[model samples]
Target: MALTSHLETLKKKHRDMSEAIDVAQRAPGIDGLRLADMKKQKLRLKEEINRLSN
Candidate 1:
């Protein structure tokens, strides 16, 4: 049950990261570098989720 909840949280973070990237794209003033950092964080979260599932 804990694993299931963790997986769900990771999925939600992934979705939020995706939306953030999209928003960054649409905005001219936002720092692209910051968006890239968020994407990296999202990647790490996915990797952790995979490790936990295994």
Candidate 2:
């Protein structure tokens, strides 16, 4: 796959994860640890997208 495609995919993944986290945060009895993990994953995806774009 092309670099641009990879970047787009990463961005989409990050957005999807963010939305998921938001939903999870709003739900009752949500796990804080899982939300933290999702945030970490989002950060890592963003870093990867930045690296690939450069």
Candidate 3:
């Protein structure tokens, strides 16, 4: 279904954001504000995924 595909895409984005967060944390010069924003987006995606799943 369309929802299934969308869910998959969101999950991928969420995972990518998680990895990005990790990489950013390890690096020295990354912007803290930007990283926080990404974390917020990732959390939003996770909420959306959960909403669609149930």
Best by lDDT: 3
Could you estimate the TM-score for every candidate? Answer: 0.82, 0.90, 0.92
For residues 1-54, what per-residue lDDT tens digits would candidate 1 score against the true structure? 988998999889888988888888789888878988988988998898889889
Worst 10 residues of 3 by lDDT: 30-39
Error of 2 at 11 (Å): 0.8
The lDDT for every candidate, in the order shown, is 0.87, 0.91, 0.93
**Each model's number of backbone clashes?**
0, 0, 0
Give a tens-digit lDDT track for model 3, residues 1-54: 998899999999999999999999999999989989988998999999999999
User: lDDT tens string, model 2, 1-54?
Assistant: 787787888999999999999999999999889989999999999899888888
CA lDDT, candidate 2, residue 3: 78
> Any runs in candidate 3 off by more than 4 Å, and if so which?
none
Error of 3 at 3 (Å): 0.9
